[model samples]
Target: MSPFAKLLLVYDGSAEAQAALERCAQLSLALSAQVDVISVVDAESANAHCAGLLSDLAFHRLEELARSTLDHAVRQLTGDGIVASGYVSFGRLNDVVLRHTQAFNPDLVVVGHRAQARRSRWWGSRSAHHELTERLGGTTIVTVTLPGT
Candidate 1:
């Protein structure tokens, strides 16, 4: 029941997300556990602009972008001798992450936390991680600490 066992990381195509993935990979190697990296497609947001008719081409594009992001992360992890898998799903970031969390039953959830000095966050919203922490009990939530404040 170590804290490092079974880690789940919420990934976006952001530098912070990459940092979180790296941290998760390090921990996965330390614990000899597999890390699941998830990237949300966010169909709901796209629906708002597309009149709920997100074109197949556009959807496919989204999927490709997500796969590229996750694949890169998986490669980094695997290259480092860490067990890893990637998943891309649709819906709100938190919802998709929670759904996968339920399925994976990870001992810990790793997410990139925004630094106040940073300009913007790409994970949709920062509060989602806070909400996740409140909703999930006994499951530890880790926020990747950036290099600087």
Candidate 2:
């Protein structure tokens, strides 16, 4: 078995994420890893923003979108000859990713680097790389960027 037998990849369907996915697909092939691609929806944000009457509906819609995105990612990876599966979950990205990391025990976690335009994320804007590094403990996190991005 390859050293990287279990690989976890985060995908948000953005162009940046697509670039990460492509690199992940290549790595999975070369390393013969089992890839788990997760698409996350921030339930905290959903509950905070979609309040009152439409909260439940908004949350449901967000969850459905997450599932759809995961499915598309899985299909793409499968077509790329990578053994992969898709998962959808709701929570803060860091928490959700860490939760899965604890469970999946992946050899490595791969993520796309966010653009500068998204530096104003909720909670004062931070890099996913930083969050994962802080919360993931011993897990290895790899950040991928599109060429010329």
Candidate 3:
């Protein structure tokens, strides 16, 4: 049996995300695994006053974009003959991914992360990738890094 029967991919349409998608495709083919792709829309409002109608509109637009991004990723994987499905989620990156992890119970979680310079990291702050990996705990994670990153 394949070590990883199910895989979850976190995609955001960035170059790094594209790299992750490609890695997932490779893994799926090698392991004969099913993949679930997810794209998250940051629905948190930046301004407290931007509520009611404005917030709703902003959220809707974000959701639409997320859906489009996810659709494209899924299409690419399916076209490659991989069994893949995708959906859009709303919330912080780590939170959304963690929730999906719980529901999907994937054997492996794949994510794309761009490396940052040591000076670029702020004091007492962690990158989103770090937070996600930590939150996932025991789940095996495969991080795909972009070239020249």
In candidate 2, what are the lDDT values of residues 44-121, reduced to their tens digit? 866667563446677788889888888888999999888898888778998989999988899999999965565476
Better of 2 and 3 by TM-score: 3
The regions of model 2 sitting more than 4 angstroms off are 50-54, 117-124
Which 10 consecutive positions of candidate 2 have the poorest summed lDDT?
A: 114-123
The sequence of per-residue lDDT tens digits that candidate 3 reaches over residues 49-147 is 365345667767878889999999999999999999998887788899899999989999999988777766755557677887789899989999998
Candidate of highest lDDT: 3
Output the lDDT of residue 60, model 1.
88
Lowest summed lDDT across 10 adjacent residues in model 3 is found at 45-54
Task: List, residue by residue over 35-72, the lDDT tens digit for candidate 1.
Answer: 88888898778878899898889988988998998888
Give the local distance difference test score of model 2.
Answer: 0.86
Clashing pairs in 3: none
lDDT of each: 0.82, 0.86, 0.89
Q: How close is candidate 1 to the true structure, as a TM-score?
A: 0.83
